[model samples]
Target: MPKTQPTIRDVAAAAGVAVSTVSKYINGTQRFSGSVEAKLKAAIDALGYRSNPLARSMITGKTRTIGLAILDIRNPHFTNIVKGANRVALQHDYTLLLVDTEESQERERPLIEALAQRVDGMIISSRMPDDAVQWLLELSKPVVLFGRSQQFPIASVGTDGHLAASMLARHLLNLGHRRIAYLGFAKSRWNDERRRGIADCLQKAGLQLDVHDAEAPSAIAGERACSAILLGSSQPDAVICYNDLIALGFMKEARELGFRLPQDLSVVGFDNVSYAEYASPALTTVDLQSEKMGELAMTKLIAALNGSHDDEYAMLEPRLVVRESTMRRPDTSQPAGVTEMTPKTAGGRRRTGGQGA
Candidate 1:
């Protein structure tokens, strides 16, 4: 007789279970009892049954896959969000496909269109404005946004950028950071809110907020942006970064140029990425619950796919993690700029450098 390949039906029969139960367990779509699980495992081992996801998906009318779009995977914060989303996807026996738009809005539409055809749903860290969200809503697949927008109508999970920055600003104000500078990207989606929060807080304290721009969200960009600020005449007593990656970069450059952490300049940052704790002075940052946000986005997306998604937005509050990076502003005001790094350009500007609804 010819050799026969073991099928899902064969395993089901061996385990005295329904074929659907066997299939569901194999696909990780649902959990099972211990006894049933043991039987299923034994049956699969004995029969050498192999699952064909494609065939199973075809019959069930589900691809069992999700697509995730991020502005830039290079950012450590986004990397942690990916980690969080992946955990939820695995728990549900689904696969995740990740793509980056390189922080370009032009690249987003094409990525979304291409990914829409391959997956049941999507989660995005969208960087565009209202029109973009409207366009995404019209797509075939369900969507969950990872950040905020005044115009977002679709479901989103986000930490309150404005509130988070406000909290940091208040903390700094309490610590007496009058000459504080903001370090961040100019084109970021959350830039307006983040700036508003800090600016408002500063205004309340009768101080003007100094804004410095970074062209990109990378560490190297941070180093370049901070270089000008560190060398400029109007050096701030403290600097608040857009995110931990940029903050870490600024810290590295500052230390290299002989600026003592929290002594010469107090520094604060957003998005408490893993490296924040391990940093030389241990970064003081906002914990945005990045992984939890990712998990929530994925969970909501799955629910939406199953016709159980709520239209309400899920907002997460960021917690401040005070480490060695931030301290009381030094008694001597007008902290000295690092003259040894480089000379500033003739221009007065920096030379080199949220949630869905």
Candidate 2:
């Protein structure tokens, strides 16, 4: 005869609790007192009992799983977002189905189709354009967007990019940096909104925000983009990057090309990623509170799953973090040969002051 699998009922019996109590505990739907919890743990451990998600989900008509689709898991910012989502999902007796889209729009459709079939709902950090609403509307499940917004008015949670861009530009402008450059692609909503903010600040100062092109959001692309611009005569004193990864790349390549950081070229980056602070000169980037945004996004998605939320959007706050990588625009003079700068001030930051609203 086949050996019987240890059931929730068996564990309940061993723990001297009602079957309902065990169910609640396993589902993370209720809390138990210390003594009761301890007894249940011991019973389950001794019996080697495991809750079958499939069996439980079948009875409830809910897979109790959420999908998290990101552009790339290799980026530190996305990793933090995933970490935050996982934290909330675990507390609700749920797990995530992670999808790395590799930043490819061609692969997004297939991945979404597969994920929708298995998950109750999804949270996507989509890199696709806003006009791709038809595909989003066709999904079988609800989706909460992270860091990216679309024209479809789907539920989203992210930083206010316009306000963030204004803050970044204001910092550079206040430090007397003229000919500040922005590095990123503008086809996405995130880029367009930020571009508007950068333009707003620059126009007020009677200066133009130089738009530079990057092959991708990675450091390698940043390096290459900066190199291309260096070949030109008009060089920006400060460059606002799409993210820390790009900023790090541009900085690395700039130093290799014999330019000293902050002394000759000040760099500003978005996303205060983990390695941003530990980079060579430490990155001065925007703190979008990415983890908090992810937590809020997951909470909103879960609430939507429970039919408790409207299809509304939530915008988090943004702020600037000053570090060693940026400073007041210096002499704008090239070093005779590897010249080092001695500045009057160290690192500092300014408050964003208000939201994009």
Best by TM-score: 2
Global lDDT of each candidate: 0.81, 0.81
Residues 268-347 of candidate 2: C-alpha lDDT, one tens digit per residue: 78889988888878887888888888799899989889887557779888877777787876454431221232222333
What clash count does candidate 1 reach?
7
> Tens digit of lDDT per residue, candidate 1, span 76-120?
788889999999999988899999988887888898889988888
Which stretches of candidate 2 lie above 4 Å from their native place? Answer: 1-3, 8-48, 147-150, 330-357
Go through the candidates in order and give the clash count of each: 7, 0
Alpha carbon deviation, residue 307, candidate 1 (Å): 0.8
Estimated TM-score for each candidate: 0.81, 0.83
For candidate 1, the lDDT comes to 0.81
